[model samples]
Target chain A: MLKKDPNFTRLKKLGGRGYLGRVSYWLGVDHLLVVEVTNYNERYRRFYFRDLQAVIVQRNRNRMWGNIVAGVIAILPALGALALLSDGEYAGASLVGGILVLIGIFILSNTLRGPMCSVHLRTAVQTQKLANIDRWRRAEFLIETLTPLIQSLQVSAGEAQSPNPATVSNPPAASAVQPDFS
Target chain B: MSTASNNVLNCPNCGKSLSDLPEMLPAVERCPACERQTRVVVFPAFSRPVVKGATAEAVMMEGEATCFYHAKKRAQVPCDECGRFLCAVCDLEVNGRHLCPQCLETGAKKGKVQSLERGRFRWDQVISTLLVLPLISCGFLLPLTSLAALVLVVWKWKSPPSLVHNTRLSLIVCGVLALIEFIGGCAFWWFMLFGSRRY
Candidate 1:
């Protein structure tokens, strides 16, 4: 069994929920931990800050498609409400307008949530897509938070660096790794 | 060199190459071919070469400890799991333990090492689904499905469990559900065959 690291803090606003599973992020001193849980079983992936190559956030048209579908389906109730209002049936109009309002709320929330995005992390050997982090805002937060930590660790570890030494992002406080069992 | 790194970070949606854009780190650009917006953040390791592991030194003394795998190679550390002496080349450090190749593989198979575990079958989900699906889809098949669920749950009760929450409660629920379905199915069948009918 994988023991939970007390030192590893769960990243704020870094969790994904889906019908199948959930993906959550935990930050260790030197590495980032991604835990994926499905049907009560968990899988873990660790990416050391020093080994990370890049993080790419790609914006997609999922919101537009969602809006289009919802709008098409909502047209009937909207027309019904308008027709009822024209016929002077205030109660019927209000009842029909309620459905349109619910649909409007859904569309408004989708827009408020902003555009959809997909985030992928690249390493020397592998590039893994973050299944849960599909928002540009969350992706930006990851980049802003991670870029500095990775730069500092690589520089401190004496790994090859192309970035300037003085401007390396200040790493989050480092915690001591657990003692060896051997 | 820059193009090589950009090649792998292609458009996730349309599978088009975004490398044609100007050379800049931490920049957002729209893929010309796919017209999708993409944000790229490159770290320092993006341009660095892969660091190689240290090689084992040859035995210089007549009585020097040797690697468990390689007899002539000098031993530098012992494996955390197996306690076998390992040379620098043979020592595989993961999470913090200095494990030999064999112990690492064994740990991976036995699920002792967290890094290597990729997936696990949730028996509770399996048993629960088996017990519920038949009742919802085909009520007549409940007896057979419930019997199967009961047998499998009892059989796998002592096996390796799910990682997070204790599945004992779920198992009990599954067992009870399965038992109820089985008894109901049997009673219905008995009534059909033996009970009086008002026709």
Candidate 2:
């Protein structure tokens, strides 16, 4: 049987984008998880092995409409510039067209990225979304690593509370069959 | 990858090992060994320390600044909100914002700061509700109520942010409803004058 250790080591670093699009990291611990939302704010939540209700991983695909709308808005000025140039306004046409094309490229590059995966820890009190663990591989690895430790902890906790097997099995057969009101 | 049998969880009521439990948590199962029931909950484990090289340094000299929360501890950083010097233990960093416990608590209670807030009041939804509901129940006061709703929508267009990502659907609905009411009022007035003359 494995003994419980008080000194916790970080098993995994979950990384994700935080508020105002800042990259943040969280520390996965055996009994406690520390989420660093920003430079000054950190949330620490402790859970017993028997208290954690669920660990959920959800995949969110990038919305194409946002990219499409951005692309369309970006090209609007360029299209307007084309109309102006056809009407013999060369200066206005060139300036607007150049700016719009650059803006469009910038939006397109950012929007071309793949979907993001998010990890969530649900307990009796509340469900916390681990913003830092956004990648599927990392999230999966965290789940895999923690499952055994949780199982071990549960087993140990259970054993500590349970009565001896020998004592339980050796009860008199007559006493087991008879219902005691007391 | 470790198999289920490698670290089998036992029933809390019984010493018997439980095998093949479902992945979903908060499950109730009868222990075969003891004929008693137990609820199974699971948590992930950590093998290493998450925060590396984070240790509270001692206050060395008498002249050096000390933490406001802990006077004996050496001050490492200043709280972003209150500008109070904080030790390593007192400095709570959230999304690049360094804050002391007092400021954190205050921000959470008042909902002034977005990072500290758990939920937010959606003004757009309020505006939309006010605009649409008045028109349905009080058709006679459509012009007055819708105008007031429009004014509110414009005034509180950028009120407190929502807990979840908002698409401004409520604002759009309010705008549409307000416009319809305004146009209907104008049409009604026009008909009252011109149609009366025609009759």
Candidate 3:
């Protein structure tokens, strides 16, 4: 008999781009595993589908902050380039602005990635914040992907608990509506 | 399980109650208290009751063994690690192991429980840094650094490896590079002193 290994396996790379440690998601038969890997340590947090209560996503100002910093960095060089161009020193102007294209790339990419947001998961006693899911699209993707799995698992458990889902007649999670900002 | 687990969805920022606007959820809703924009995804468990935990039962028979901790309660099962008798209240089921409190504590302290491991020191990083630092910054100290790397590879061979990366390959590569660097450094020094003095 061919038997599948009943263990947490690698899943989609759900957003967790940490500065010091990278947090990645894994999937098991009944739970979602969040592993944070640092240079010296590996921390684990598991959220079972049956116990998952809610997913809260909040808008953040990451891109705005990032662009503001990039703008500050680009200012001095931009002024220098303009002064050189006014003096007809095209060589100096190009040289000054050429390297500062790094700021342009940063701003463009950040803007194209869309608005940044933070996703949080709440259970009965614990509310975990996933700072890694910073982008709006990633937050939406995370919620969209997890809703069905959690809903199905809860429905099966509810079936086992009672014959009809009188309590779950109007399951909010089962019919999760997506926000445009997610 | 508590009904709070299923029916409660509060503002993540100000911790204010948003229960009155429950129908407008899974959308961008500004909190009245903090006025910060929030989007909440309510799952099935948001409306479901909390799953109740197993409760301890009274003694079933006169001849039945009593719990080790509780004199009046029935002994339901034996601990997986220590073989101690545990009642319903005392028997903590984790990964199918009906362990007593003491056994669970001991196992956690010793890192015997895989699920309880929070972190591990990456010996691979230590050894790799030892081998590579001198080569990039101080070429003259390469021999000594290589020897230290080699020694660390042998010393921490049985230590816990990195969970994110393949560590055995790193250890092997570090050991090999260290061996070659040490041998090359020794040979170069030997030739510089003796070979140059050839009469």
Candidate with best DockQ = 3
lDDT digits (tens) for residues B44-153 of candidate 3: 66666665676777887787888899978888999888888888889998877889999888888787886666666778788778777777898777778888889988
lDDT-sorted candidate list, best first: 3, 1, 2
Task: Please report, as a residue range, the 10-residue window in candidate 2 chain B with the lowest summed lDDT.
Answer: B44-53
Task: Work out the iRMS of candidate 1.
Answer: 9.9
Question: After best superposition, candidate 3 residue A117: deviation in angstroms?
Answer: 0.2
Winner on TM-score (1 vs 3)? 3
TM-score for chain B considered on its own, for each of the candidates: 0.81, 0.59, 0.75
Interface RMSD of each: 9.9, 17.1, 4.8
Of the true interface contacts, the fraction found in model 3 is 0.56
| Per-residue accuracy of model 2 over A1-182 as CA lDDT, tens digit each | 00122354454355456563333332234354443333323333444454454455544433355566777777778689989989999999989978887877766664554334556665544556665565555666666666666666645654674543433222111100111113
Worst 10 residues of 3 chain A by lDDT: A1-10
Between candidates 2 and 3, the lDDT winner: 3
Query: Per-prediction DockQ, in order?
Result: 0.26, 0.04, 0.47
Runs in model 3 lying further than 4 Å from the true structure: A1-9, A87-89, A163-171, A180-182, B1-6, B21-24, B50-55, B58-62, B109-112, B137-140, B184-199
